[model samples]
Target: MAVAWYRARLVESRPQTPTARTLVLRAPGWPGHLPGQHVDVRLTADDGYQAVRSYSLAAPTDGDRIELGVQSVPDGEVSPYLAEDLPAGAEVEVRGPLGNWFVWRPGGTDPVLLVAGGAGIVPLTAMVRARGEAGSPAPFHLLYSVRGPDSLWYRDHLAEDTPGLDVRIVYTRTAPPGTSRPPGRVTAADIPGVPAGRVYVCGPTDFVEAVDDLLIDLGRDPATIRTERFG
Candidate 1:
């Protein structure tokens, strides 16, 4: 399919965590998107210089607005612009809903295991939302790893609303003094008890690679696992 650019209006923007923010864009005439797809955002300056970044859509496919969960890197150019500079009602150029065969649609029969590191959970969150809304028979599980609670995206949503999905949050840095959750990266033991089915993973290149290796060591079918790496 051809890529189309839309002039989208920022409708809502809020901090999902101390380091990440969720931005909602409203583009009335923009074509809708599929789950697990991403969009390219272009930022321009008065000097005519521009930068672009690709971000996965966090909202469910059925939602009218596109949601992006952005985490700020130490000196990330585009992320800082999005997280700090951009404000609600700002117009932006977005070309999106693009990908090949990576979508997770509702009504599927197989159970889904999502492994995410840091902001990688964005796309999988959309899948979880879609399945929950459709009341699909398949089971959903999530293994999300972050430095700590401060960097965990969508922590409140997962805590309050994800009653139907199995979620395990792993923290790898200095945990709060009394935290009871696992205080290291995700391991094979962290995965929930479920039958072999589909596994989707996303994270930094090294993190994704390590998780893939862990899955293999756990006797999971390599062919059933899919991965997408960023950074």
Candidate 2:
């Protein structure tokens, strides 16, 4: 079946960091998407030049609306605009609800282990919100890795004490004052040993691969881990 493109209007835009932002789009007639699916956003210039990029959905679809979190690539074409200058009411074409293996459906009590590196938090955020929306009793533990405190996304929301969800932030570049964890990459110690249920890992290629290796070393079944690597 062919997935048709829908013209979506930007409903809101909010910055997550100096180089990243979250976008809310209202696409009429949108087929609601599952958590962790992504969409291709098409942007056209006045001269007929078109650029497309895939962004993970940041939240579960809400009626005619959807959300995405974009991290600007230093010299990329589409991200800078979406992350910095795109305005509300501007229209763009969206095609998808893409990728099946990475999705987390509602209504499961199995524990979920989410490992995110940098902007990889986007889709995992959707899973977290989906769990809440569906009233799922799934236990969730998120291990998020970032450069430092300033680059962390969902700072306030993750800080909130939510039942059944545990979040740990690992700073690779700079650790906050008086913290016991040192500034370094994710070590075996950062990952839980042998996740009993599904384990989702998303990040840059290197980060995902490293975490996947660590998970395997920790006695986790490799088949139980699903990874999505970007960049």
Candidate 3:
């Protein structure tokens, strides 16, 4: 079957952080996707100019709706519109549910370790939501590095208990009040006691590369890790 572009209607939108928003889109007849999949969204301007960007699904596949977390990039062609301007009931052209290497399914029993930097949490959050929705018993750990507590997306959702989910946050620029960890970049020492498992890391190109090298130096097999860079 030939691939096709589909129309996605914005059903809901909410703040994920000060600079980002999560949009829930309704697409009928949409085939479901595995966690970590992304969609290419296309927007057309009044003068016929168009821009396209790929955003990962942030929630577990339910049936007809999918959630996307978009961060507004300064002077960006597409991100600013999606993150801060798009309104509910508007329609956007989308293609995909693309990618395979970075996806996770409920069948795996290995411990799931997720590492995120900034907006990269989009896909990792999907895996977290998937694990809970499927009632999968696999142990899950997330080491999320962000600028500060205020920049974190899905802060409330992440804080909610979903059995077997463990999270540790690292502050890069500033830490919250009464915090024990000083604001600093995530180093090799910040990793939780996660056993050898399927590790997924997502972030900017440089961040992903550094984490990949760090994981390798820590004695992790390169083959066991999957990564996606989205800067």
Tens digit of per-residue lDDT, candidate 2, span 127-165? 999998888999999999999988999887788788999
| Model 1 global lDDT (CA atoms, 0 to 1) | 0.83
Give the lowest summed-lDDT range of ten residues in model 1. Answer: 155-164
Judging by TM-score, tell me the better candidate of 2 and 3. Answer: 2
- Candidate 2: which pairs clash? none
**Ordered list by TM-score, greatest first:** 2, 3, 1
Residues 1-231, model 1: lDDT tens digits: 579888888998998877688899987676788778889999888899988899988877544589988887779989987987798799888997787565787878888899989889999888877787788878888888888767778766688555558887888986777778647877778776668888999989999999999988888899988898899
User: Candidate 3 lDDT, tens digit per residue, 56-77?
Assistant: 9998787878899899899998
Which of the predicted structures, 1 or 2, would earn the higher lDDT when compared with the native? 2
Output the TM-score of candidate 1. 0.92
**Residue 207 of model 3: what lDDT?**
89
The TM-score obtained by model 3 is 0.96
lDDT of each: 0.83, 0.92, 0.89
Clashing pairs in 1: none
lDDT of model 1 at position 177? 75
lDDT for model 2, please: 0.92
